[model samples]
Target: MAEDSGAEKTEQPTPKKLQDAAEKGQIARSKDLGTAFVLIGSAAALLVFGKMLAMAVLTIGQRMLRLDEKDIFETNSMFTAWGDAGGELIMPLIGIFSLILIAAFLGNTLLGGFNLSWQAAGPKASKMDPLKGLKRMFGLQALVELGKSFLKVAVVVGVAFFLLKLFFMDIMALSLMSEPNNIESALYFLGWLFLGLCASTSLIAIVDAPYQKWNHVRQLKMSLQEIKDEHKNSEGSPEIKARIRRTQMQMSMKRMMQQVPTADVIVTNPTHYAVALKYDQGKFRAPVVVAKGVDDIAMHIRKIANGHKIPVIESPALARSIYYTTKLDHPIPEQLFAAVAQVLAYVFQLRLYRKGKGSRPKNLAKELPIPDEFKH
Candidate 1:
């Protein structure tokens, strides 16, 4: 979609879109904010480490000045003296530079967070297009950057002039101070100057940072069609989901029917409902419903039971009770235990009779003791 159509982008960018953009390294960041942070950090480092650094420099300079003419004249002595001076300054310089580097890292990552994407750094054919390059050079972003540069120059110069005027007397007094005092006072005054510049840059950063974030989000605003397409791709369309659900239900029903032959007995509501149950003395505390159904499904269960020679009992109330109160593959409710036990007992007797080991048992009682809660 053409991003030029502002009216079409009524919806905010989804989290997936934002994450995709971030992965591509298209994150919102303000260079001005980073610059401000670095400047302020540098200023702070200077304030904290300036005395130690100055002492190191002074020590090095004094050592060099005190070098004997013989040492200066000899190649080995000259090299040795220079090496010692360098060693004297290394620790203080490392301390100051390490702090500055840390500040720079924090400044760059503060708004957009740290992201390392090779795609952003890689070369692209699109980036080489002459027309696109020209367009970008003359774009609104270019104009904004140009205006920002001017504003920063104006603010820095203005602040510097103000600070100089405010500290005119103190600065002039530095001229009257002698040798080491003059250098120390000058370093102190320079620290204040750095702080003032940092403050001015921070003000510009404060304004620019919010604008950068808002502009980034505005660019990523999504159209309604785009959101719908994203949703369809991520979660699938409603018709496909419904079809998947239907297939799952069919598979589940087929699995339920397969357990029908394993049932000890089938209790039917004559025509409307059927429940198949299994019980084992050691395996279950009570009979469990292995399969159940209604109407046409009930007829299918009865047919399967008859083929397997599993006893089928016509008991409407008991069938309804087990069907309503028990889940497939789960034990019957405690309240239905006595009623299911009676049914199982009769099934056992019928099996023994068919084997010619005992006399045929009487049919199960019609009015089995079903709990009122499971009456339906």
Candidate 2:
């Protein structure tokens, strides 16, 4: 009915749906977050490694200026000098780039928790469809992205202009200072500029990260019919499950009936309950219930016992006690040992009497020693 009515996708996406989307590389991602991390990380790396980088640069300058007249005349000497300068600068450069790379990777993964899918990488025919392409270009999500882009650009440009204006006097003062003083002052201004850029990017990242996550969830929302369909697919339809349970019960009943023939006697509540018991002094310490059931199953057990000429004793208290307290193929409770002993002794005596090996046994007691606890 929900499908016929074209139900709205009001329910949250199920775990399975979320997993499937992630497998297809459809996960929340904010480019602004990554940009923020890269910018912030670049500024930090420069701050930490600034002295080392400055020393390397100074070494390179010193090496070039200290060139002897003989070294200037020789191409091999000049090549060696260049190589030494490059080697001096390599370590600090590697450190800065590595930090930036780590920051970019972390920023991308922090929200979506890192998913890689070859299915997403593979080419699809839908991607080439012009009509779908136009729809995507003008989609609500596309408009949202465009708006974020404009906001980010505006923020970054505005901050850059503000920072430049605030540092105008300092920047002018640097030109008056000589040599290394001007260099240090210039680096200080650059640091503040990097900080401003990082702050602006962070502002966009803060807003975009949560919006991306919310948008991803909205895209994956499930309709009521979809949730029901998924449940049926995963757990099997109710009709099929009921059939499976019925089949299992039938098989179990068949097995129970087979054990009825092996029982020494069938004890019954006359109509409602039945329990078949067997005892062998050499094989068991106590009599065990071979099979048991209630109502229709009780009638079925009695029929099978009659077909096999097994003794059927109408002992309501004993039948109910054994049926309720004992499991199939397990001994009756120790508290009911005296009650069961009486029944077993009578069956043995009756069997001998029917074979003409012994005289007829007297009538068994009507009220057996059923313990209070065992009374059902």
Candidate 3:
């Protein structure tokens, strides 16, 4: 089992493994996916409400730049007016952010479903380990992440620069245009550039979400021995199961011993196997094995039968057939009926002779007429 600890994780995770992992907040979600969603969602929210926000900003700018010397010189008036300007902007900003927050939640849920991970939120001492933190943040793996961050930044920035360069003539024309026309042209180009950046960033999420899911599964993959151990845990541990089996067998043997006294006869291999049987003409149509065993147990059954004055007959083949094939308290198998009947009739003859009601019958059958199918 210890060796199996090093075994390859060659098996797919079982459903129980996935469920357990999910419960602990170990779900696959791409950071890029959420980032892209928030960016794109924020851009859309802005486009829809840009005019309202622009009006608030323009109002604040007008108040700040008013040509009234009295307003500029009055500190209390200036502060009060600025505060009112801020209030106008804050509400629209909050609305935009609330929309972005909803978008982020939806994106995360779409990727991995909802998982409230108490464990992820709970404080952990390992997080404070400077050595571990340093290794994670600035180690070899960190370089890979840092390189990716640089690449992402460069790609978005490069595309935006290229778009700006492509519209160089429009940018230059802005200087000669009216102020309102200049602002509109600038906004039109900037909006398209930002949307393009978000679209490109989203491509990263397309690959990352699936990769995260596959990696999460790889981390949870199980080895053969791990599967066995899990099965054992689900059913029961080996030692407890073995002890339970022994306890059950002991109880069964005790019950069988109790039934020995009720048996009319016990057939034996004489030394190795024993099968005690009982039959009542009105109670049962066929003989039932009341108790049975082999080796030491067989000898024990024989001793009990002897103590109860139950007859014991040595019939190795018949004893084996009944012991192996018949369940306690169940009728001997039908194929074994003739063999058992011969033993019972012989037992009955002995009883009659013992009671002094008749003379001894002929010698018992040399062997029970065992059917080939019933042979051990």
Error of 3 at 160 (Å): 2.9
What are the runs in model 3 whose C-alpha is more than 4 Å off?
Answer: 1-23, 38-118, 128-135, 140-142, 163-194, 206-252, 280-285, 345-369
lDDT of 3: 0.83
lDDT of 1 by residue, 259-341 (tens): 99999999999999999998888998888899999999999999999999888998999999889888889999899889888
Please give the ranking of all candidate structures by lDDT, highest first, separated by commas.
2, 1, 3
CA shift of 71, model 3, Å: 31
User: lDDT of each structure?
Assistant: 0.89, 0.90, 0.83
What is the C-alpha lDDT profile of model 2 across 131-222, one tens digit per residue? 99999999998999899889988999999999989988988898799856566667767877887889789999999999999999999999
TM-score of each: 0.90, 0.83, 0.59
**TM-score of candidate 2 to 2 decimals:** 0.83
Best by lDDT: 2
Q: How accurate is candidate 2 locally (lDDT)?
A: 0.90
Instruction: Arrange candidates, best TM-score first.
Output: 1, 2, 3
In candidate 1, clashing pairs total 0
Q: Give candidate 1 misplaced runs (Cα > 4 Å).
A: 1-7, 68-87, 116-123, 172-175
Kindly list the per-residue Cα lDDT of model 3 for residues 269-321, writing each as its tens digit: 98999988999999998999888888999999989988989999988888888
